[model samples]
Target: MAMHPLSDTDIGDIHSQLRELRTEHHDLDLVIAHLIDNPPPDELLIRRLKKRKLLLKDRIFLLEQMLVPDIPA
Candidate 1:
């Protein structure tokens, strides 16, 4: 969905959300690594975690784009 031009407050809120998503994404990275490092890892749980991480990554990218104004060439 295309968001309308955001007010400063809205942008701030978005920025906060971006930080939270990034933190979660980083935590997921650690969790995923631990899951892989342990023997007899639960493949199903790892797969789910990986999928969640991907989704969070996508959201982070989108929010970053929204926060940064694109420069025209």
Candidate 2:
């Protein structure tokens, strides 16, 4: 299906979401690092956090792509 062009509001919303997701992703990175450095870390928790971070990264990438208008070469 063809995609509709994003309006100013839509772009603004996406920007807001991107900011939130990026912040969360960064926070998760710090948390993961902290968890790893401390004594024995909980593998399960770390794995779950990493998975969540990956999902956030994917979402951030998709939103960023949306902001870029498609141009015919």
Candidate 3:
């Protein structure tokens, strides 16, 4: 599928969004680690955070791919 041309502002916006997502993902990693390392009383919260982290990972991958044009092998 062909993507529409993006203006400079659009690229910048995506970059900003990417950074925000990465930061949030990293924070989630820390939180999950702390929760597991300390063995929190609520396992459900940890599970939710893990699930959210997985989703953020997927979104990050997708955005990165969008920025990098694929080359024909």
User: Where does model 3 exceed 4 Å of error?
Assistant: 70-73
Candidate 1: worst-modelled 10 consecutive residues by lDDT: 64-73
Backbone clashes, candidate 2: 0
Best by TM-score: 2
Error of 3 at 66 (Å): 1.5
Report lDDT (CA) for all predictions.
0.90, 0.96, 0.86
Candidate 3: RMSD over Cα atoms? 1.8
lDDT (Cα, tens digit) per residue for candidate 1, span 1-73? 4556778998999999998999999999999999899978999999999999999999999888888765555
**Tens digits of lDDT, candidate 3, 1-73:** 6777667898788899899999999999998888888854479999999899999999999888778765656
After TM-score superposition, the amount by which residue 55's alpha carbon in candidate 1 deviates from its true location, in angstroms, is: 0.2
RMSD of each: 2.3, 1.2, 1.8
Worst window of 10 by summed lDDT in candidate 3: 64-73
Candidate 2 versus truth, CA RMSD in Å, comes to: 1.2
User: Whose TM-score is higher: candidate 1's or candidate 2's?
Assistant: 2
lDDT of 2 by residue, 1-73 (tens): 3588999999999999999999999999999999999969989999999999999999999999999997766
User: Which pairs clash in the backbone of model 1?
Assistant: none
